[model samples]
Target: MSTVTTATNATTTHRSARSVARRTAWLAGALFWSAFAVLEAVNHGWLAGTLALTFFVLPDLTFLVALDDAPRMAKGQLPPCAVPYYNALHRALVPLALLVAYTVQPFFAWAPLFAALCGWMAHISYDRAFGYGLRTKEGFQRG
Candidate 1:
């Protein structure tokens, strides 16, 4: 094979490996965090459990913000108006940051906040493991 062909093959191989690693990492995260959230609920109270469950389903509710536009869009695409909300909610950093904040300040009641963050992280992790991720400005999954 030509040098260019060899380079292309190497790049593709690298990307494929990275993709597998990424998916595996997220899957592990989903399992751990989801379990952590459940444990927190069992240990703490209904408040902890309820908040965790609520936040897990909350991110996807952004779709309701642009329901009318959803029909015209391609499958797996968020409407442009809802893209910002979807992207923000889907990002792991947001919940991670909140968890850090809770650690630093201890301002909120601990158990519920912790459980909610864990659940949110679990949701994001599951989405990533399944190949969903933050949307592009055009509302399509980023390449």
Candidate 2:
């Protein structure tokens, strides 16, 4: 093969490896956080379980905020107005920060909010594992 072809192949291989690593890491995070949420529910009470389930499904509901704009968006694009809410919920740091705060100083009786954070993190992790991520300001998935 020519040098250019070899270089292209190498770059592609490197990117493929990085993608696989990223997906694998996110998958692991999903599994761990999901399991932790489940355990919290079992150990705590119905409120913990309910909050966990709620937060798990809450992030995607941001789409409803701009449902009327969907018709004008490009394929696979979120509505621009909903992008901020979607990006905010999909950010792992948000839940991670809350989790750290809970650990440092418990609140909401600890278990329910903790479980919710775990579920939220699990949702984000699963999205990342499946190659979904925060959108750009224009609502397209960031490359």
Candidate 3:
């Protein structure tokens, strides 16, 4: 094979590896969260556990709806703002805010605040584990 062909093949293989690794990481994260939610439900109750799972997965859902690059940037549509709106939901502050609210009130008949907090943490962990760090205003993929 020509040098150019060899380089292209290497690049394609690298990208394929990265894609596979990313997908695997995502699958692992999903399994982890599902197991956690199930265990929580078994210990607590169904409603609270489901709520926790929903909160845990909320950031990704919001990102898919609002800030994902494929539907926006790939289509040549500029984002309305420099920072992606999803970043706001993905930060540690989300869980901190939940913690503060729980501290202030401490009253819950169902769906404890801890579940939401755990969900936020799980989201962050999954992103970090999968190498999906925070996106900068400059591009779709950045720390």
Candidate 4:
């Protein structure tokens, strides 16, 4: 193998380690918040729970998307198409889903808080499994 290839491989491996460390810490935090959401949902019944799930869980996931973009974009990538993507998840998809699940749904209604909470968890889990969020010698981009 060539020297450059070897060095590149080593760097990639090292970066992967750093990324995983960052991702792990991030995921741990998400888990804590997700747990809080679940507990709150249980207590609040529906409306409050739904709000809490969106307010709490969405941020947790959006963070992962931020993390994923770090290596590619040195600039803080705050979900470039975030508003549209977020709308799809929180507004269009979720409400429609809720309507299908429980008919006679009312406006200003809270859907399944558990489902929203799960959505957040899914993001964290997906990053942990696939993100390879490694820190590089270039270091993390600072805002």
**Better lDDT candidate (1, 2):** 2
lDDT (tens digit, per residue) of candidate 2 on 40-140: 99999999999999999999999999999999999999999999999999999999988888888745457889999999999999999999999999999
Candidate 1: C-alpha RMSD to true structure equals 1.4
RMSD (CA, Å), candidate 4 to true, equals 12.9
Model 2 weakest 10-residue run by lDDT = 101-110
TM-score of each: 0.93, 0.95, 0.55, 0.40
- Per-residue alpha-carbon lDDT of candidate 1 for residues 20-83, written as tens digits (9 for 90 to 100): 9999999999999999999999999999999999999999899999999988999878899999
lDDT, candidate 3, 1-143, per-residue tens: 69999999999999989877876776676566556656666777766677777877777654444454545464433343534655776676667666567667747324445665666666775776666766666436562
Of candidate 3, the 10-residue stretch with the lowest lDDT total is 74-83
**Top-lDDT structure, candidate number:** 2
Question: What are the lDDT scores of the predictions, listed in order?
Answer: 0.93, 0.95, 0.64, 0.51
In Å, residue 45's CA in model 1 sits off its true spot by 2.0
Count of steric clashes across candidates, in order: 0, 0, 0, 4
What TM-score number comes out for model 2? 0.95
Clashing pairs in 3: none
Tell me the TM-score of model 1. Answer: 0.93
Instruction: Kindly report which residue stretches of model 4 are placed more than 4 angstroms away from their true locations once superposed.
Output: 56-143
